[model samples]
Target: MTPAEHPQPNAPADPASPAVELTPAAAELIRVLSAVHGPLMFHQSGGCCDGSAPMCYPRGEFRTGGSDVLLASLAVEGLDEPVPFWISASQYALWRHTRLIVDVVEGRGSGFSLEAPEGVRFLIRSRLVRQPAS
Candidate 1:
């Protein structure tokens, strides 16, 4: 895809804490997939079927745009570049108050996701963030 066709991950401030994280299992799986696919990225669109799950794709394979939000840029050991995680703006809207934890489980994900062929799928588990009362 043309560079102009895809949305860039936001260079958001380096917050004191990240809003997203990956499980060790998930990071290992990502390492394997990245070795095979080169670089990779993640996006959750809150669509239908597999859309509810976080989908992994070869970096830039999926086109993101204004409707998407950059959730985090995760640094996994053994990977040269940080894997950017994104979410549909609407999904971020509904989930803004939560911390997203990405995990892997035995199952099939979207046919479009790079992990689908590996017999495992990537999923997200979230926890509500408790903000200090103003």
Candidate 2:
């Protein structure tokens, strides 16, 4: 599909308990990111405990799989290039166990975030965050 015609992730077929939480700080940040960057990208990579998790970026272009779900899309000015990203298989396993899916939205202090279940918060720049894309 054309970039402008990008499709959003269809609401899941099954509803489950929320596995992630959002702090007031996180909520405000996502609002800004959404207003500025537009759409965010979610990705994960290898690491500890949770193994790795999701992140967001301003929407542009991405080289991805046909089955890859497009959760949402945004158009931000100035950032005209696609930012590359990846998430670890281990992290994906964690996400699968919970109803929570890593997502991209505006953020505070950091450019992105990892909102865990029950208001637990983590910044995008933490060691807990990974960039397999790098």
Candidate with the greatest TM-score versus the true structure: 1
Q: Whole-model lDDT for model 1 versus the true structure? A: 0.80
TM-score list, all predictions: 0.84, 0.39
Q: What is the lDDT of residue 75 in candidate 2?
A: 26
| Predicted candidate 1 versus true structure: per-residue lDDT over 1-134, tens digit per residue | 22123343322133355688889999999999999999999988888777799989899999998888777788999999999898887887677667789999998875688888889998899876644234
TM-score of 2: 0.39
> For candidate 1, which ten residues in a row score worst on lDDT?
3-12
Instruction: Write one digit per residue (lDDT tens) for candidate 2, span 19-95.
Output: 23334554455555555656555544445433343454444433445433332232223344322343343443333
> Candidate 2, 113: how far from true, in Å?
8.5
Candidate lDDT values, in order: 0.80, 0.38
- Residue runs of model 2 more than 4 Å from their true location after superposition: 1-14, 19-21, 47-53, 60-62, 66-90, 99-134
lDDT of 2: 0.38
